[model samples]
Target: MDTPQNTALMRALAEVPGPLPTSGVVHISLPHTERFTVVGNHLAQNAALSTTAVGFAVRIQSLPQGTEVGIKALAARFPEGEKLIAAALRELEAHGYLHRTRVRLPNGRMVTRTVFCNHPEALLRPRPADASKRGPALVAAPVSTQAPAPVTAPVSAQAPALVAAPVAPHVPAPASVPAHVPAPAPVTPHAPLPAPEALETPAPPPVTDRPVPAGPLPPAPPAPRLVPPPTAPKAPPRPLPQPRELTPGLQQTAVALLSDLRRHAPELVLSEADIERLAPATATWLERDAHPDTIRQALTTDLPQPVKYPAKFVRHRLTVLLPPPLPGTEELAPARPRTVVIPLQTCEGCERAFRSRTPSLCRDCRTACEQPAA
Candidate 1:
């Protein structure tokens, strides 16, 4: 089938240097070999249906029978969520692609039944002659068999043929199908028949807002008790640490440090009574392993010129800026050195056993022996 020019053109198109730039959509449609559903263009290109509804109809058509298509199932399967999926399903129902009805099971439980039509237009087509045997007739009088005259306009001018039309009560077929044309029936002159305009149009069916359950309604749930929320209690203020007791040596050190503060700051001169009264607070600091120079620096550094009350300033600093106590002695103390016992050896001169690096006399014996030698 290839000519020289056609082959060159095909080769050029096939041998694209790289991806070609495209402003609009470029479809690379491939034939689906598996898991494909045939959706008609009526549903796909419907102006009334939303994009979500079209996509949902395609997905539902592709799904295997008995698979869960419930709102929750769809919400879990896709990210659009239940509300949008429900709206899309309603759209499908309104457009004749889907129908949902309630059926009472043999076990006395009610369940929803769903019916899907791939080609919705077939529903409006003429029914077969045996359709009347199936159920009660929708029309009270015999249906007229006369065919409607053909219109000269195109297909779009006429109403679309429905697929899977609901079973009606002895309703006659529409005029669309030419194959079902029947011969005119003989009429008697005694009675004149009514024209098509004179015949009454069937009233529209009643609107059912929701499917009613067959059994009695369940009892109403009891009203919930309203319990008051518990009130939060106010928090109490934190307590300060109690002044620590100190040993006699620590107390003397504290008093000495306080007395030496004047050496650093001459204005920080405290009297004997003042030192004695503030000794305990300083001793508390010392008890917590506070160094002497550190305490002196705290009490003397940055002294206010001509301090009217040095004792009060020192007391306030000592109380407000007291350092936290050091960890316990067990934690702060160094690990103890391992004790090694030396083997006892006999001394060469004294013939007495003594502990030493080499054979030697004891301390007292060595001193005595060395004194005799000197």
Candidate 2:
């Protein structure tokens, strides 16, 4: 802020007391509140008042609600006005002088509305359970068929009918010339009723498929129930990986692997994120029981010089080269024999009741049976 450019600009610019040029002579009206705010508030008296942010804040405060606060509009007032307004707005917000709220309209869209405060005590973060949150003070109530009290104006017997009176019957000229009676002035429609009373006015029954009711509508059908949608069963979450213990050997391997990748493609600037994301790929390769040398060779063999987006390329290559997960020791162990052995059977021919490997008879008996009986 104390730079030479700022000092030179300050020196170069001088205030000339005069009215701003418009299409013609013009004037702006301000209430006592706004005039006091401009003159007495921090916007005009603070340390930042020399900066464009203060001026921008003053302008924002001076304008009434619904005024266009776009960058273009602000640029018309301050030099480099758009950027100035943006900075000023941020400053105002940071200083608790401005904040915004999101309001969903009936059309099912959300919009941000800037809430500026000349004497704001708005906080940056609001508590979750606070009773007051951003919304309109009033919400709309549903319409019902129960009729509102009908407004009745006093009826005069001599009052004219709502419809235009029929044109006076033309009379054949009794005399050669007669004075023509001036036609009555046409009546303009009356102004509409105020909106609050308009809603309160009684409406006629809606036309429908059913004939006009002779009696009352069979107590109008009960209001439709708002049934909640059926929920779908949730899928089981994937298991998270267990933390890896970095032994000296494994750490060396990881470092070497990283070193080899960097050597192959030096263009990539590795970060902790790249390391973390790529760690899984390396772990997968190791879990598949791949040799460190093989991994290095696969990466270095087909690598094109000067890889573009090297981190991603390396990630894809590592994933492509990932070996399947290794089987656990339990899966690969031999099936154990039963502890209790069955008694052996003997051959019927030899009167040996040995437990036979062959079904229904001993091996010798089966062999003998298989041979031709002689």
lDDT per residue (tens digit) for residues 1-374 in model 2:
66456654344333324645757744444356534545345456678444776767777787888876656676775577565677776666666566655789999999767766665422323333323444444534436464433333444566437423335457776455446966458654355323444444454444445467687645433333222222335776433232255455555565557656666556655666676566656655665678877777776676665566766766767766556667889999999987966667656577777764553677677788889875
Off by over 4 Å in 2: 1-37, 48-50, 70-83, 121-374
Could you estimate the TM-score for every candidate? 0.30, 0.26
Against the true structure, what is every candidate's RMSD? 27.5, 19.0
In model 2, what is the error at residue 285, expressed in angstroms?
18
Q: Which stretches of candidate 1 lie above 4 Å from their native place?
A: 1-24, 127-374
Please provide, for model 1 over 20-133, each residue's C-alpha lDDT reduced to its tens digit, 9 standing for 90 to 100.
Answer: 667764444558998677888888899988999999999899888888888988899989978799999988887677777789999999998887778777655555543544
Model 2 clashing-pair count: 9
> How much lDDT does each candidate structure score?
0.74, 0.59
